[model samples]
Target: MDIEDTPVLDNHMHLDPIEGQNIDAVEDFESVGGTHLLVLNKPSWHLFDPASDEATFEEVFELTIEAAADASEVLPGRAWPVLGVHPGLISQLVDEGYTAAQARDIMQAGLDVAAEYVADGPALAIKSGRPHYDVSEDVWEASNAVMRHAFDLASEVGCAVQLHTEGSEDLTEITEWAQDEGLPPEQVVKHYSGGRLAGPIKSVIAEKDELEIAAELDEPFLMETDFIDDPDRPGAVLGPKTVPRRVRWMLEEGWEDAVRRAHVETPARVYGIDTEATLGR
Candidate 1:
C-alpha cells in the first residue's frame, strides 16, 4: 500500500458522535472514495469532564469503541481506530477554576444521553469512593494515570493512539514518558497542532520548533483543523468544509505533502494497515 495507490488518507479525525452531528467521518470517508481513514477516540463518558454530567468516561469510551467496530464492519477493514483521551477534554477536566459540581453535571448529562448507545467502564478504584476532584494537585497525576491505562487498553486492542498534543506541558511530558515506557515514537500521532494556543505547545508551529522535535524523535506528526461547532467557544468553529482550506495553508509552506505522507506512510507501518490494499489497483 502506498499514497499513489490510494485515493486519499485522512490521518486526524474524530469519528464518534459529537454534539449532534450524525454524519460520522468514517461514512463520509467511504462516500468520498477515501481508501483508509483513522478515527481517534474521545475519552470515556465518566471521565469526560468534572464540570459536566453528560455521560461517564466508560460510557463514551464504549460508544467510541462501538463506533469503531461498526465502521470496521461497515467498511470491511478500510477504517481503523485511534484510541486515546483528546487534549481538549483533558484541559477542561484539569482547569483549576472549573468547579467539580459543574464538571460532574456536564459529564453526567453527556454520559446519560449516551447511555443507550454505549456502556461504561474500566472504572477506577476510587480510594474514597468518590469522583476525582479537579482542584487537587493529585487529580492531575491521577487523571494521567487513568489516561495512560486507556492508552494501554487501546494498544492491547490493536488500535493506534491518536493523541492531541495541544498546549500542555503535561501532554509533551506524557509523550516523552510513553516513549520511555517502550511505546514506539511512531505509535503516537500528534493532532491539532494549529488549534493549540497555550502551554509549551502553544507556539510550536509558530516557532517552527515541533518539526525539529519530530525529526529528532522520529515520530509521525500531523497538523489539523478542529472544525468543531461549539457555542461555548463560538470563535473555534471553522465551518464544516474547512479541511481543504487548512490543507492549502499547509501546502503554502510546502508542508501539505510532507505531513500527509508522513501521516499515511508511518501510521500504516505502525498499525499494520496495508496501504496498497486500499489503493485497489
Candidate 2:
C-alpha cells in the first residue's frame, strides 16, 4: 500500500532555508500527499560549532523559525511545529567547557533571547503560558539534570519532542536521561533513525531499546527521517524516500495498528487535534 496516501503527519522536517535553497521546493512534499507537516528546528549545534562547516546557529534558527512561521500561517491547519534541541547541543556545551558558572551564563543567555523573541516564540506565546524551547546545562552535569529539564519542557508544551540519536552508543545515555526527566518512551521521537550506525546492527539495537521504552511508558514511539532529500544537501541522512519506506516497514512488520494507535490516535489525543480520522477532512 502507498503509506503516504494514508495521510501521515511527517513528525520531522526542516522547512527553513539557510543556504538560500528554500526547502519549500520539497516542503509541498508531493510524494506523500502529506496531510500536516511538523517542521523541526534547525540543527543549531552542528551549525554553531566551529568544528563544523555548517552555518551559525543564530542564522539557522532565525531563518528556520521565520520560514516555519510563514508556512504555518499560509498552510494554517496543515503545518505544525516540532522545535528541536538535540544531544548535539550537549556536545557543544561540553566542547565549550561548560561548568556550573557556564550553565548560569548559558541559561541567562537563553532567557534573554527568549524574552527578546517571546512574542514569536512558540511555547512562550502559547495560550497555556509555557516556555517555547526546552533547554539545559545538565547533560554536561554528571547527573543528567539538564536533559531532564528539556524533556519536562516538552511535556509542558504538549508537542512531540524531537531528537537525533546516532546509534546504540548514546541509546543508554538517552534512556537514562529520559527516565530521569520522567518522560516515558512514547513521549519522544528519534529522527535520522537510519543513517547513524552500521547495518542492521544499530537499527535493531535502537529499535529494541525503543520498544522496551515504549512498553515501559505504555505509549508508541515516533520515528522520523530528520534529513532532507536534496542531493545538494549532502549532510542530510534520510531524504523523502525513507519516509514511505518507514511506513511500509511499519506495516509489513505488523506495526500498522501501532502506527495508527501511536502516530495518529495518541498524537491527536495529546496534542488536542481531531483525529477521528486523518487530517484530510
Candidate 2 residue pairs in backbone clash: 138-146
Q: What is the lDDT of residue 262 in candidate 1?
A: 44
> Which lDDT value does model 1 have at 151?
43
- Where is model 1 more than 4 Å wrong at Cα? 1-7, 16-19, 24-35, 42-58, 66-77, 86-136, 150-159, 165-172, 194-219, 227-241, 244-260
What's the distance in Å from true for residue 108, model 2?
8.2
Winning candidate number (lDDT): 2
lDDT of 1 by residue, 22-97 (tens): 2454454455344444544545432344333433544555555555566555452354444333333434654745
Model 2: per-residue lDDT, tens digit, 195-235? Answer: 23221111111243443333244344444455543346743
Task: Count steric clashes of candidate 1.
Answer: 34
lDDT of each: 0.41, 0.44
Clashes of each: 34, 1
- Tell me how far the alpha carbon of residue 218 in candidate 2 is from the true structure, in angstroms, after superposition: 11
**lDDT against true structure, model 1:** 0.41
